[model samples]
Target: MSYSIIAAELHKALQDQDTALVETLASELNPADLAQVGHHEPASRMAVLLHCVPLDKRAATLGFLEPQEQLAATAGMPVSELAELVAHMSADERVDYFKQLDRERQQTLLKALPPTVRDDLLKLARHAEGTAGAIMTSAFMAIPAYYSVARAMQTLRLKGADVETIYQVYCIDTSGRFLGTVSLREIILASSENQLAELMTEEVIWVGIDTPQEEVARLIARYDLLALPVLEGERLVGIVTYDDAMDVAEEEATEDMHKGMSIGKIEGGLRSASLLDLYRKRVMWLVLLVFANIFSGAGIAYFEETIEAYIALVFFLPLLVDSGGNAGSQAATLMVRGMATGDVRSRDWARLLGREVFVAAGLGLTMALAVSVVGIFRAGTEIAMVVAMSMVLIVIVGSLIGMILPFILNRLGWDPATASAPLVTSIADASGVLIYFAIATAVLGL
Candidate 1:
């Protein structure tokens, strides 16, 4: 059934206190779909619905809910039940949920959990947010290098159900230092007499615990890894799975997209964000750009004599300035996307700038040719000459600004995505105004 119809039925079942029907409906949906259904109900109702789900699925369902939604759904539930629910959550997700709790709740939850689970949660939670350690899971399969293929198979049979993934298993030495990795496929195909040390690939690709999550995602994508092992010193700490890296990539992409439009990150995403959240994310950029635009006005005011001498110049102002802004915005978008994907770097700026100059000149000349025809029909030869010259200079200047701003931002230790389209356009508009009038004054002899 469609989630929408299921959601309606679930809501009615919850309203009617039909526990059996709720359980049947909740069971029919997977954890992700069940979370979507929860979105249609109030927090209190969702909490009751969660209790009807099987214990194995309950924690996963809760994990899929937004952090705030999870907290709200669990509010007023008994501490013992909460701990039971938390115990069933994955290691990384447990730490994430634990971090959202207040000190009192955190302490209570920790006290209620098994000592091993509590210690593990605390260890994973201690890593700085936005780092590899924070997102990596301790639930990965790791076996000692001395184990024979037969022994490794026995170990997987005994413990694989508890780990996040059995596809790529890590190998460690006696002292818990990382040795290498052996895939399950290799283990299955090898003779039982062969030791894991022989089967494992010694040349392992890994990251330190403190590595940035963005870098982790990039490495995963670059290498096409299933799971990247994370180390602290020489000891294996955890593994960042492909799924988690995908989440990081999505989040970074969304944040860049928001910054591209000159908007701040909107917490909880757009669907759940309040009107105030939307306003707060967007208002600062709009207000700042308004002030930035004053320079455009000032440039026009400075060219009063030029405009008065040839009133025809006023006709082309919007077209010329807007063309420059559009060109600049296009350049900024390309640079920002290139930097984000690691295809471009700050060191390439000089080479890119040289290429862009040639490219921009070509673009400017072409645009100049197109606009000059309109200029001639509207005014005369002098006006056409002024407009065509302004178009070339303004487009070249605008394109160069767009292409270079991201590199400048990156060199200053800022996110290149912060060199957003709106900001670039504002700067280009102001420069276009100044360049157009200067060319007009020189060409028309105003």
Candidate 2:
């Protein structure tokens, strides 16, 4: 169920003052849903839910809450309660929760925590946000390669409570260098006498701890993995799960969608962010485009004398230019989306470009013929020829432009989505108008 349903349940339970109902229901819900419920309601109701659930669940569940709710729930938590929560949290989620706290509160939590655990968390937090190191949880299963299957199984059993996943177990040498990986099924299927090194598969792909999360996600998706090993200066640091990588992929998609629509990144969740914030993010692009629109107007005005000489030319000018822009926008949008999702890569540029050119030529010829027929019927033979010629030229030019803009943007280290519908259409509008008027004036000898 959505947060709305949870909120309704909580509100009804609260009015009934049904503590047992609340506790039982909250336990049944997933952390995400619970977090959303806590976010929708205020501090008073939230505290009750927190008190009822097992403290570990409360802490883990709190990780899912918005930054404001996180602060509200934990600001008054006692030293003992808070320490348990921090201890129970996975390293990445712990650091994320700590990051939302102010400096003074952070110090208090650090003071309460054991020095070793505190240091580990602070070290993890030191990584720049949105990197492999930042996203990876320190919770992982590892064993010495020389350890027997029975011993390795024992270690996994002991550590499984702390680690997020137990499927991929990294094997290390005596010096802690990463040696290989073993799956749970291997351990179960292997003879108990065999050492981890003997059973482990050495051909494993891993990412450097410093690798950006985007690249990590790309690699994981490319390789089709359940988990990827993380390295710090050739030493195994941790592992990032495919689940986490999927989250990164979703974020990348969202950012691209924003750019495609000509809006910059929004600071918070789309539903919760303020109207002013949304407007502020979107207005800069609009203002820049407004100034750019003037340049387009200038292109139109440059051929003002020609338009006056051949008054009939103005009638089809908009139609010709707009059609070109629409075609380019369609092509650019498809190419951009393909590139983002890795459906169309730089390597496929040759094939994609060839296909687009053929399609554009065919479309231009067909469109020109249709426009020429319309022109002949609407005006006369002379004007029809002008219209037909301009139409073909504009469409051909627009088609090439549409196919090229995305590639150029990608090569320039900008997102291809930045060459979105509005921007591409705007370019086509300006360029097509210029091509149309220039072709018309020359053909008519005006």
Candidate 3:
């Protein structure tokens, strides 16, 4: 049924304190959709809705919801109850929820959790955010290399239900060094007598615990791995599953998109972010960009005499500057995306610049031609010639500048995405205006 129908029925059942019907309906609904129902409902009501789900499902469903929704649902819930529910959550997710709590609440919850689980939380929390270790789940299947396929299967049967995934079984040596990996298919198809070492792939690919989450995502995507073992030196510590890698990729992509538009990360994302939060995120970039535009203003002032002589120069100004900015933004986007996906690297800066030169030249010529038509119609041959030359020059300069900025930022140990589109566009606009007026003054002798 539709969400509206679900919400209506849920509302009625909640009003009547009809626990049995709520529980029945909750069972039929997917956790994600049920979470959506919680989004529209009041925080008080959201707790009632969460209560309808089975305990194990409740934690999973809560994990599936956004952090804001989770906070709202659990707002006034008892600390002991919250701790118990959080303990049931996946290791990574549990840490995520725990970090969102205040110091006092965190301490209270820490006390409520069993000592073993609290220690696991503390260890995982120590890993720096956006690292493989931080995102990976400690709950993973690692079988001894000496175990026979039959014994391995038995171990997996007993343990698989609790771990993140069982598709890829990690093989560890006696000293707990990571030996290799064996898939469930390998174990199932092989003779029962075959040892895990015989069944496992000897050439295992893995990353160190401190590896960046983005790099982990790239490895998973490149290899099509279900899960990758996270190593602390030679010992297997945890596994970063494909699902977590995908989530990191998506979150990074979203962050990049926001940054590209010159907006910083707004907590709860754009849809749920408060108006004040949205204002803060956008205003910083816009304020900087406004100051950056002063150069354009100065450039115009520098050529005040020329501008007055050919007042028509003012008309095509936006066309000239905007064309360059658009070209620059286009190049920046390609370079940024390539770098983000690991297809491009800092060392490839020269090669990227070489390719971008030819590409920029082609784009510059095409855009120059397109804008020249307007130039010729508006102000005749002299102005048109100036506009065309400026277009070609500015577009080439803008695109090259845009393409190289990311590489420069990356080389300086900064996020390449910080060379954002608006930043490129603003810089391009200022330079393009200078080129346009300078060329006009030279070509027309104005």
What are the C-alpha RMSDs, in order, of all predicted structures? 1.8, 3.0, 2.1
C-alpha TM-score for every candidate: 0.95, 0.88, 0.94
Which ranges in model 2 have alpha carbons more than 4 Å from their true place? 1-7, 14-20, 42-48, 72-80, 309-318, 341-351, 366-388
User: For model 2, how does the per-residue alpha-carbon lDDT over 262-338 read when each residue is reduced to its tens digit?
Assistant: 88887546855789989998998888778767867998789889878878777897899888988988888789888
What candidate 1 gets wrong by more than 4 Å, as runs, is 2-4, 11-17, 274-276
TM-score of 3: 0.94
List runs of model 3 lying over 4 Å from the truth.
2-21
RMSD of 3: 2.1
Compose the digit string of candidate 1's lDDT tens values, residues 294-379: 99999999999999989999999999999898889989999999999989988889999999889888988999999999999999
lDDT over C-alpha atoms for residue 444 of model 1: 72
By lDDT, who's the top model here?
1
State each model's CA lDDT, in order.
Answer: 0.92, 0.83, 0.88
Top candidate (TM-score): 1
Q: Return the candidate ranking by lDDT, descending.
A: 1, 3, 2
- Screening candidate 1 with a backbone cut-off below 3 angstroms (N, C-alpha, C), the clashing residue pairs are none
* Model 1 TM-score (2 dp): 0.95
Give me candidate 2's TM-score against the actual structure: 0.88
